[model samples]
Target chain A: MSYSPPRDRLWFLRRRAYLVFVLRELTSLFVAWSAVYLILLLDAFADGALPAFWDWAGTPWVLALNVVALAAVTFHAVTFLNLAPKATVIRLDGWRVPDFMIVGGNFSAWLAVSALILWVLW
Target chain B: MSPLRRRAEPYLWLLFGGGGVVSALTLPALVLILGVLVPAGVLSRPDLTALLSNAVVRLALVGLVMLALFHAAHRIRFTAEELLGVARWDRFIALTCYGLALTGTVVTASILF
Candidate 1:
């Protein structure tokens, strides 16, 4: 029997698949960073510095940037949550948690955390 | 190594590293919920800086940051190598990521210490 590197044997197929995966995941970096930037704004507001924060956040370009960031964050969260099951290992009493359950659990946790944050600020 | 083991090495590293990040982030949150929030009768009264600056907390934070950054960097490098026709430069990319991760860890330690 003979052996060959998988990349050499399935060059184009592997490349296409990996490219798609990478692009999808790379967008997540933008999303995650945007959330961090948003937290900075929130921190400023919490410190009673809303005037400065709003001045920066209210600029037309800044507003547009926030919108894009929010969209990216949402997209990244959705895709990342959806793929969490495959990327993570979860076992309960020798039984594996279903993929749908993992996704649902992540979304539920996110909602709960978001609600808590909103309640705190409100 | 067996063929299957060799094939699985990269993915196993990613999963282990990624899982470490997730756990490091989540454990403190869980502790805050059970140890502080419920005990203090407050929903979100935990002090972020104090908790994050604690020795154990800082260790976990640094671990999560370094591992996640390296994991992301490696994954990105591989993707760039394949998609951007830079396959020959994968080693360079990997070395760059390693350097970044090492620098990050050192800076974080200095700040925390």
Candidate 2:
């Protein structure tokens, strides 16, 4: 027999950072939801039921679901980008990039791409 | 236990990290076009059907979905154990999460290709 410590299931709530971590984990569901939505888009495209795609996506509930999923995915992306430098080490010419530089560059690139997409669509 | 189980963890983790990178790089832009701009009628929907009709785009979409799905599955599997304290059910958790991801990947590929 070995000793096992009893722990609260709500341990995540006891600390703010842990809560953020848990929320980040929960974002996985929405990430999967986005993938599912993308699958539907591809399926509709493959079958040439193109109008069906627009028609279904236009539904209020679908819009709402997409809105929620979008929010979650956005949070996931932001958190991951902010956390990335901690998990990564980039060196150029035998010099490591500073953490702020890495995070700032990641954010700058994200903004540039987002602007590009919006620009093209507009 | 499968002989590959222990060895597969690191690779799966790599996939998760790669997927996170991919999601960060692509999904926000997608969400902006899809979630906010289009729905708000600020940006008109382009020839998305024509755009995605390209084989390369379809393949890329499949890759994105596949990796994202696996990343979700791995993260959720651990989250389930942590939140629910279901460590004793690790095998069940892994099977369910990974199985769903596999199904999603197959369906994504079949539909895309």
> TM per model?
0.53, 0.88
Off by over 4 Å in 2: A1-5, A92-94, A119-122, B1-3
Tens-digit lDDT track of model 2 for B1-113 = 56788888888899899888777777767865765556556666567766666888678878999889988998999999999999899988998988998898899888766
Tell me, by lDDT, which candidate is best.
2
Query: Fraction of native Cα contacts kept in each candidate?
Result: 0.02, 0.63
**lDDT (tens digit, per residue) of candidate 1 on B17-104:** 5633343233223333422333334553334554444578557756655554555455555666765677776557767855665665
TM-score of chain B of 2: 0.90
Using Cα atoms, each model's DockQ against the true complex is 0.09, 0.62
* Per-residue lDDT value at B68 in model 1: 47
**Model 1 lDDT at residue A105:** 88
Extract clashing residue pairs from model 1.
Answer: none
**Number of the predicted model whose TM-score against the real structure is largest:** 2
